[model samples]
Target chain A: MIHALRISLAIIALSLLASCTPTTGTKIAVNQSEISKIKSIGVLVKKDEDFSVRLSREEMSNTGAAFGLIGVGIEAAVRRSSDKDKEEQIKPSLGNFDPQAPLTERLRFHLQEGAIATSEVTDGGEKTAADAILEVTVRQWGLRRCPGPAPEVVQAGFNVNGKLYRASGHATVWEREELYLNGDCRPWSMFRSEELANDILPRALDALATKLVYEILYP
Target chain B: MKRLIRHFIFALALGLVLSACVFSNANVNLAYKPVEGSKSPLSTVKPLKIALVVEDQRPIAERESIGNKRNGYGSVTAQVKSNSDVLTVFSDALKTELGNNGHTVVADKEPLYDVMLRVQLKRYWTDSVIHFWDVELVGTINSDFVLGKRDGDKPILSQPGQGTFRESRQFVTDSAYENVLNGALSEFVRNFSRDPNIIKALQQAGQTATPM
Candidate 1:
C-alpha cells in the first residue's frame, strides 16, 4: 500500500514540475561544418528611421467579452498608471537609440566569447569587402504592455523584426517576418519600471540579438 | 481512509495548477476602416453619372491568414484569418469615394450613367506573416479600371489603381488589421479618383468611344 502511494505521489510531482516550468523552445545549435565555410562574419543593420520605444495601453478590452464588465474601468486605470511609470523609465533608452548598436554589440560579444572573429558591416561595407556579412534590416520594432506567463500580471513586451541576409554574394540566408500577437507565454518580465528599463527590456533585446546571430551562424 | 483523502487533495491541487496553462484561442475579424473618401471629385464641368462594376480576378476570394502562434508544446495559441467578403468591402469603399467626389453612383445596369467603369481586380491580400516577437501588418490592393461602352470588347482607357501599405505594431488585433487594410484601401480609392485621366476619358467618351 505504501509503495503504491509513493508511486502515485511521485507521478503527480513529476507532472506538476513539467507543466509549471518556463519554456525555452527547442534549440538548434550551429553545425561546425557550416561555420567552417566562413572565416569571419560581419553584421550590417539597415534602418532609415530613428529607433523609438512607445509605452501605450494595451488595446485589449472586455466590452464585448462574456464576463467581467464591471472591472474594465478599474483595469484600464491601473494599466494607465503603470504605463505612465514604465514610460518614464524607458524614455532615456528610447530616444536617440542606434538601431544597429545592440545586435552588432551582442553579435561581437558572442563571437568573441566563442573565439570566432566577427566584424561590424557598416554602411557602404557591402561594396568594400567581407568574408560574410549578415545584413539585418529592422523592419519594425516597439515595446508593449502585455500579459505575462501567468494571469493578472503585466510585462513590458519588446517587439522586433530582424530580416537577415548573407550579403557576401547577396544570397538570402535567413528571413523570418515577425507577425506578433499578445498573450503568448514570454519568459521575460519584471514588475518594477526600473527593472524593466534596466533589465527586462535590455535582456529581451540581448536575447533577440543572440537569436539573430544563432540563426545566421547555423543557417 | 486518510490516504484516500490525501490522494484526492493531491489530485485536486494538480488539476488547479495545470489549469492555468489553458490558453484561449484568439478569434479575429478583419474589416476596412471608413476612410475619409476622395475629397475632390475628378475635375469635370458636370457631375458624372458613373455606373461602377468591380470584376474580381484574384486567385482566392479570401486572403491568406496572418498565420498562427504555437506554444513550446505545439498547441495553437492564436490564429488570424481574413474573415469578411473583401469584394463587398472594396465595392463599398469605391462607391463612397466616388460619391464623395460629387459623382452620382449607380448600379452596373443603370441606364442614366454617363460612363461605365469596370474595375478589374488583380490582387488583394492583407496579412501579418509572423507571430513571434514583433510584427508588420501589410496590405496590398491592385486593380486596373476600364472605361468605355457597356458591351464594348475593348476599353477606351485603362489605368491601374494600386495601394500597398506596411504598419508596425506591438501586437495585432482584429481592429488593428482592419485599420491597416483600410489605410491601404483609402490610398487606393484616393489615387483612383484623383487621376485626371479617368475624368478626361469620361469627357472624351461623351463624343468618342474608341478603344485604347
Candidate 2:
C-alpha cells in the first residue's frame, strides 16, 4: 500500500510540472446588426475624377517598407505564443511594423469577398465601369507609435484614414479614421507590436467595415 | 515488468520537457519598423499621418503525416504556420529601421501630419517543389488629396524577393530572417526617400524622426 501511494504522488507531481501554459485572447469583432447594414447598401462608383473609388496601386505600394528594418535584432527578444498557435509557448516578440499593408490588404481581404464587386484595375488615363468609387488616400502609412517592451505594456497603435466618394458624379460619400492597438503579453516578451499588428489589423478592418456600412447605408 | 515501467516513465518526462522547449522556440514574435535610406535621405512635401491595415487571413493548420523521401522512412509531420506571423516579421523590421532613421512615425490619430504611408504584403508563400519562399510588398503614399491633384504624383514602391530558405537554414540562428527582411524594407525606404517633396515636407514641419 505504501509503495503504491508513493508512486501515485510521484505521478501527480510530474503531471503538474510537465504541463505547458499558453496565453489566450479573441480577435475584436463588431455587432451583428452593423455587419448586416453594410451588406445592404449599394453605392455606384464614379468613373470621372474618381480617385477615391479605387485604392490606387501607387498608394498601395508603400507596403514594402516593413521588410528592410533591423536593430538589436530578434535574437535577444523574447515572445509569447500567438493565439493562432496550436500548442502555445512564450518567446520573444518582433517589434518592427509595416504601415501600409495592414489597412489595405487586411481590410480588402475580408471586405472584398463580400457582396460588392471588387477588382484591381490600372488607371491609364481612362475611366472604367464600377459603382461608388473608393478613393483610399492614405495620408500616412507606418507605425504612428512604437513603445518598447517593459514592465509597462509595449503599446503599438497604427492609423489609417481617408475618404470614399461616389464614382459616377464624384461626390464625397464617406470619410473615416482607423486606429489599431496591440502589444505587451508579458514583461520579457516585449516588442511584439509587429506580430500584434497581424491580429489587430484584421480586427480593425472588421470594425471599419462595420462603421463604413453603417455610414453608407444608414446615414 | 517493474524495471520496464520505470524506464518508460523517465523517458516520457524527458520527452515532454524537450517538446515544450522546442515549441517555445518555434513561436517567433516580430515587430517591423522602417529606417531612413542610407543613400537617399527622406524628403516630404507635407507632414504625414499614417495607418497600417494588414489582411492576415491564414488557413488553419493542415497537418500531413505521411511517409516521405526526405525523412527516409519516418513520417514527415508538417503543419501550416500562420501567414500573419510572416508579415509581422517583415513589418517589425521596417518599423525599427525607420525609427532608427530620423522621422517621426505617427502610429495614431493626429491632424498635424499631412501624408500617409501604407505598407502591405499581397502574397507570401513557400513552394516545397522549388524550395523557395516568395515575399511581395505593396507600398504607397497618400498626400492630402487637394482638389485636382494629378494621380501620377503619388509616391509608390513595390519590391518582391524570392530566396532559398534551405541555403540559409544552417546559418539561421534567429537572425537569418533579417537578411530577407532588410532586403524588402530597404527597397521601400530608398524609393520613397528620393522624392524631393518628401524631404521638403519633413523640413518644413520641423518634424524630427523619433528614436526607438
Best by DockQ: 2
Best prediction by lDDT: 1
Off by over 4 Å in 2: A1-219, B1-26, B29-40, B43-76, B79-89, B124-212
What is the RMSD of candidate 2? 21.5
Q: What tens-digit string does per-residue lDDT give for candidate 1 at B172-209?
A: 45565455566667656644654445656777765543
**lDDT values for all models:** 0.53, 0.32
Candidate 2: Cα lDDT at A121: 28
Query: Lowest summed-lDDT stretch of 10 residues in model 2 chain A?
Result: A49-58
Whose TM-score is greatest here?
1
lDDT (10s digit) by residue, model 2, range B1-212: 99999999999999887544323222222233342233223322322333332333322231121001111111122222332456556455445434445444554355444334444343332211101121221111111111111113444322221111111221122222333333323433333343333344444434442222
Native-contact recovery for every candidate? 0.00, 0.00
